[model samples]
Target: MEFLARATGVVGGAVARLRRIGTPARQAIGANPQIPQARPQGIMTLKMPVAQGWTDGRLPICAPGLRVAAFAADLDHPRWIEVLPNGDVLVAESKERPAPPRTLMDRAAQATMRRVKAIGDSANRVTLLRDADGDGVAEIRTVFVQDQNQPFGMALIGDRFFLGNTDGIVAFRYEAGATSLAGQGQGLIGFKPHGHWTRSLIASPDGARLYAGVGSLTNIADQGMEAEEGRAAIWELDIATGKARIFASGLRNAVGMAWEPVRGTLWTVVNERDGLGDETPPDYLTQVRDGGFYGWPYSYWGKVVDDRVAQDPALVARAITPDYALGGHTASLGLCWMPAGTLPGFGDGMVIGQHGSWNRARLSGYKLIFVPFADGAPSGPPRDILTGFLSDDERIAYGRPVGVAIGPDRRSLLMADDVGDVIWRVSGA
Candidate 1:
C-alpha cells in the first residue's frame, strides 16, 4: 500500500503541473466546488516548496476602488486579530510548536512540513495596536500580553480578558486602556498535547459564555479514536465558572468562527482532512448547530463515508452536510461576519482568509474573500476583496493571510499576514 501510494502521488504531481498551465488562476472557489473522488491515502503527498518571496517596498494588490496598506509592520508571525470596544486592535503573534518525534515517520513528516511553512517557534505573546489619530496605520504599538504558551485567540469582557493557548484556556484581569499585562493568568482548561495546535477562541455576544475551537490530534484519527477525546470539537465555557462542555462535535478543525448578527447563529471555517487526492471532501463554512456532527473521519459532506477509517453505521447516519463549501484544500481559516453597510457594496457577508494549501500540487486560496449573505445565510458566490498574496510565478508566495476582522473604524478590514509579518488595513477608495 505504501509503494502504491507513493507511485500515485508521483503521477498525480505530473497531472497537477499540467493542469496548472492555462487554467484560470482562481478556479478552485465557489459554493459547491468540484471535488475529486476519494483516493487511497498517499504515503508522501506533494509538499509545496516555500521561498522568502517578499520584496522591499511592495504591497498587495486590492480590489478595484480599494486600498491596502500595512497598518502595523514587523509583527512576529501574527495569526489572529480582535478589535476592542475602545478601538484598539489586539493581534495574536503565534506560531506552531511541534512535539518531539515519536517515530521515524513523525520526524520525516515534520521535516517536510517545515519546507511548506508550518514549523515555527511560538511567540507566545499578544500585541496591541492603537491608531489614536484615526489613521489607517497604527502609531502606538505595545505588547498587550506576554510570556505565554502558543496563544492564538483572545477575548475581553469588562475587566476580564480570556486567551486560548495551545494547551489550555486562561483568563486575566483587564483594565480599560491598559497597554500590557504584568500579572499571572488563571488557567481554565488544558488540551491534549500536539497535532493541530491552533486553538481559536471567541466570546458570546452577551459575554455569558466563551467558545474555543480545538482541532483533531491527527488526520483521520490515525492515532486511534481514544487520542481524539476532547479534540476535533468546539467547547463552550461558562465565563463565571471555569467549566466547559462540547458545543459541537465531528468538526475536523474549526479554525475560525463568528456569530451572525441577524440570526445570532454561530458559523465556522473548517480545515478538513488531507491525503485524499487533490480534492475529495471540500473544506467548508457552515452554521454550527448545537450538538451538530459535521462528519470527520467517519464520513464527509453528510454521510459520504471515507473508507480510510473504520465505518460506524450509526455515526454516519447522523452526519450533517455543511452549508457552504470553500473548495477542497483551500484551508479557509479566518472567518468574520460583517453586518450590512460595513463597507460599500459589501452587504452582510463573511470575510474569510484562505491560508493557502501545501497538500495539493497546484496551490489554492492565498487571498481574502467575501461571501455575500442574506436572510441569515450565505447567499451569493464569493467575491475577491484582497488579492496578490502570491507572486505571478505561483512558485513563491509573498504572504499568507490568516485572520480577518473589522477595524475599529468599522469601515475598514484588518488582516494578519503571517508570512510577511504585517497587519494590513483595507478600506474603500
Candidate 2:
C-alpha cells in the first residue's frame, strides 16, 4: 500500500504539472483560434504521454535549487506570490486575524473573510521587493497598502496588476521600472468569501481571460449545498468584458493552477475533503475539463466514497471524483513543471508542495515531490525531492510553504512560506 500510494502520488503530481504549465517563453502567442477540449460532462481521467529518459524513478533529495531567505515583515500568513519583469516580487500577506465566534461544526467553515485581520494589523498588506543595488537579491521595497483587509492572490497583466481579496478583485497600475503601484485601483467583483477563501488567479497569455479559485462554501455539508455550498470551483471571467462563470466544480479546494499548452489543459492541485480517517480521501492532481465536476460532499478519487457525506441524499451521482490521486489529506498546493533540466532524472518534470499534514496523527507531507512528463504530459510516477522540511524525529516543522513561481530569473525558482515569513529562491547549482 505504501509503494502504491507513492506511485499514485508520483503520477498525480506529474499529470498536474502537465495540465497547468503556461508561458509564452517556448513559443510566441500566435493566438491559435482553438476551441476548448471536448470532454465528458462529469468524467475525470489521468492523461499523459509515453516515457523516455524520465522513466527511472529518481529525483533530487533537496530539489537542486532551493535556498531560504527572510522577508521584511514578521509575516504570519504570506499567502500569494508573483514575480515582476524587473528583479522584484509582490507578496500578499493574508493576515492571521482572530478566529470569529463559531460553534464546533462551524469552526472548520472559517475562511479569510471570517477573520477580521491576519498579522498584527486589522488590514491585510501587500509588500514589494526591491534589490536597490545589483546585489542579486532583493534588499528593500515598499508596502503598497498597509491598511487593506485580507489580500489573497494576484496576477500581473500588462501595466495593471489584478488582486483578489476576501470580498472581490482589485486592480493597480504596476510600474515595474519604479517598483510602485502608480495609480488608483477599482473593485472588479463583490463575491462573498467563505472557508476556502484563497483566491488564486490566472490570466491568458494575451491577458484576456482571468481564472480564479473559489473554494467550497461548506466544510462538507449537503444541507449547505443550497446552490452555493460547493460553488467552490474554478471561475472563468472575460477580463475585458467582466463576464464570469463557473469553469469547473467538485473540487473541495484548489489553490493552485498551471497550464500545459503542449496538451492544452489546465491542471490543479486540490486539497480534498477532510474529516475522514487518516487515509480515507486522497488529495488529487488532474486536468480540469470545462464544466467538469469532481464529487465534493459525496465521493472522491473516482471511486472511494467519503463517509462524511455518505448519508446525504444530494451526493447521489453528480460528484465526479478525481483522476490521479495522492495520499489522503496531504494539503497539496502550488504546482509547477520543471522544463527539461540538465540532470538526467529531471528532464520534463513536475513539482508540488505537499503543504504538510494537519489532521493525521502520524504527520505526513511537509516536503515537495517530482513527477516526470512525456510528450508534454505526465508519464511516470512522482518521487520525493524536497523532503525533511518537517522533522520526522519530532514531527515538528518550522515552515509551511504555499505559493510557487518560476521566478524573475528565467531558470530560477521561488517559494512563498506563510509560516516562516520568507520567500525562498532556487535554481540549478
Best by lDDT: 1
- Model 2, global lDDT: 0.60
Best by TM-score: 1
Residue-level lDDT of model 1, residues 85-150, one tens digit each, is 999999999888788878655665665556545676778899999999997999999999988888
What's the TM-score of each model vs. the native?
A: 0.92, 0.75
Model 2 lDDT tens row, 317-429:
65565545556556778776667653334667566777665444344566666666676566766676555455434223555557777666556556666555666665554
Decoy 2 TM-score against native: 0.75
Give Cα-based local distance difference scores for all models. Answer: 0.83, 0.60
